[model samples]
Target: MRFELARLFLLERKQSDAFERRAADGSKLNREQWLREVFSQEIDFIHRKSERRFVPDQSRPKGEQRIVARIGRKTLSHENDPNDHLKEITREQWRACLVIIDPTSHDDGQKVAIETSSIVGSGFGNFESLITTINGHSPPEPFVIELHSITDQTTFWEYVDRHKGKITSIALEVVMPNMFGGSSSFEEDAKQLRDKEKARKIKETIENEDGLEPETERMRDAVSYATRGGGKVKAKAKGATPYDSTRDKKYIEADVDSENRDINQKTEAAIEAFNKDENEAVVEKEV
Candidate 1:
């Protein structure tokens, strides 16, 4: 009755002859739209009727809109634990098919043309058999891979690399951020401001008076200490490897306390100074 079962019959079992018989009996033109209609009906039914069954079963709240196969929560059932049920229906078994519902603009009367070719290029259609072959009993996990931006390839690789071994279904969806007001100026100005802010931070940190100052007061002290015999104290303390000494020019001691009260006081002061400097550094960045 479900699309998944129909698909399983058609693809996995190769029952085209049987499919034609069922299609005629069901009064459907062809199997494809019939399958989609069945799937839509099932989704609607589950949404309206399955709520009570799902309430206690699925403990966690789902996103506002989500593909049930990939991100939906599961509940403990009479048959098995939640984990076992989820393991039975994992993303590793099938791929996903996604469609983006972009928000339309009433002001400019313009729709952003998202390049779907790249998504198609990413082997989206390769999962047609998988999607068709799914059974409702154990639907393969569906990943709604939404491209928030066409220019950003990082997100694409992240999804691919992260789920290379586990992905069964890949549904590509894309949506541009909804624009507000009758102006493109806000978006353009925001971009320019971000670029300018980045440049300002880079220039100030590199070529300004603050750039000449030590990053932290403790760092200054550490530099001074290194220049004096204090560097040898840090260099020789417990766990002082040549590599560690060369890089940090400081000691690493697990169980050793300060050798004297004077050293202890300086270390305490240095730590306090370092913490103060760290906070001030963050505050400066915010300003």
Candidate 2:
């Protein structure tokens, strides 16, 4: 069967080659026959060497497989560190390729397991150059391509006309690096700051209220005074102060532990005042 297939392929190639030779010799060409011969060769090649026929069992279940083509030294990392310097140095050294995924024959789901092909480029200019290269010199072997970002679909389709049949689908994901901290973290910090401010306002209201005993007033004043320097103390505690590490050790460090203790005490005292007022009202009603 293999021998027969090989012979059939050789015969088809000979026919196509003969048409080219005839046209080169200034002979009146049969256009339809020439087109048929060219198409026949392409179909024969696809049937024999296309990557669609060799997908593994494990990948079939997922309906798609993703393979990253490592074309540069810098790779996507878990830490999400900046790679601007590395990318700048290795800009010219980058290369790109295409990835093809062929669907399995046994899929029964509504979502048709699409065979996707992606052409990767290091950057926009490099990608355009890569597309031109593919147009001029189409590679035979299937490659795994990584698209760290999306390319213009129109531009891509223009160059990929040759291998359109092998590609059943195209899926491109644009992966942008998270340079700024995540939105969730920023929102959480804002919420915490708001809550702390609310707590500080409540403590101030309790300290300024009239009709308290002299000792109670003195206690409230002391708590308020203690918590007044909380901003600087909190900044130091969180290592946000520029002078935190550089300060001379001859002077004693400001006690952040005491600052936290004072804030907690003031918050508790405000809550206790509310509870005490409620208890007194209940006692008066009983009497």
Candidate 3:
């Protein structure tokens, strides 16, 4: 008897690669023939030497495919892998190749999983890139979640190249609430609390009864103060300095981009503040 098997990724997210497929008529490509035809490029993995067959004599619901793969194994090389001479093997595994093209951004990687690692230890193959390629969708550039300081120069350039044409302008801000460690966004709860408190304080400080300035101006003023550094300005609206020698550090070495671009007023203020010592250390960065 053949084994009935699958690893359900129907609840998987629709990230850059993990998406669904559709027919030319804007319908679900759920039929065996349709799926086989749609996943032609994926099934054609050079090393996998895989063949897919449609089993119609199964007692299953509609849109459920009885796609079987008789895949040939090959030794795959992985860098810095602890295992030596990696190899794979598989039987004629029967799985429901779930290609749900329900016509929405929300989709599961069921088909992607079925094509890749549905039955194998490391997965049969990665159909994500193939999907992107076939659909003319380019892979997203890596979104770096790193410390404002201690950035790798070589890696930074690589990222810059990836980011070109995607962004029109780039602005740097002094990262706030130095606290760290948490899930979801790796942003700490305490940091979030601190940010909330900071926002509250800014609202209180900026919205004086004398003449209420625009909320945007107040926020920008506070950001300029925090990023530019704290020094008692003659004016009140300009004195949203949250960070000072009493609060955090009096100052920090500002990273200045070498690119020839117009710096906004906030940036200009920050630069002016940082240049008090004239010879104040500045890092030349362009990204």
Q: Which tens-of-lDDT digit does each residue in 1-287 have in candidate 3?
A: 01111111111122323234555675544433333444342333332344333222222234434232233333344344236454443333243222211111111112111222344322223332223333442332111111111112232223334443332222223333231121323124324644554421111232333433332443344333332221111112223322221122222233335564233322333333323322331222111
- Report clash pairs, candidate 3: 116-124, 117-123, 117-124
- Could you tell which candidate, 1 or 2, scores higher by TM-score? 1
* Models sorted by lDDT, best on top: 3, 1, 2
Superposed model 1: Cα runs more than 4 Å off: 1-15, 19-28, 41-71, 76-287
Candidate 2 weakest ten by summed lDDT: 1-10
* Candidate number that wins on lDDT, 1 or 2: 1
- In terms of lDDT, which candidate is strongest? 3
At residue 81, give the lDDT of candidate 1. Answer: 39
Q: What are the lDDT scores of the predictions, listed in order?
A: 0.25, 0.23, 0.28
The TM-score values for the models, in the order shown, are: 0.16, 0.14, 0.19
> Evaluated with TM-score, which candidate comes out highest?
3
- The runs of at least 3 residues in candidate 3 whose Cα sits more than 4 Å from the true structure, single-residue gaps closed, are 1-37, 40-42, 47-60, 63-121, 132-287
- List runs of model 2 lying over 4 Å from the truth: 1-67, 73-122, 138-287
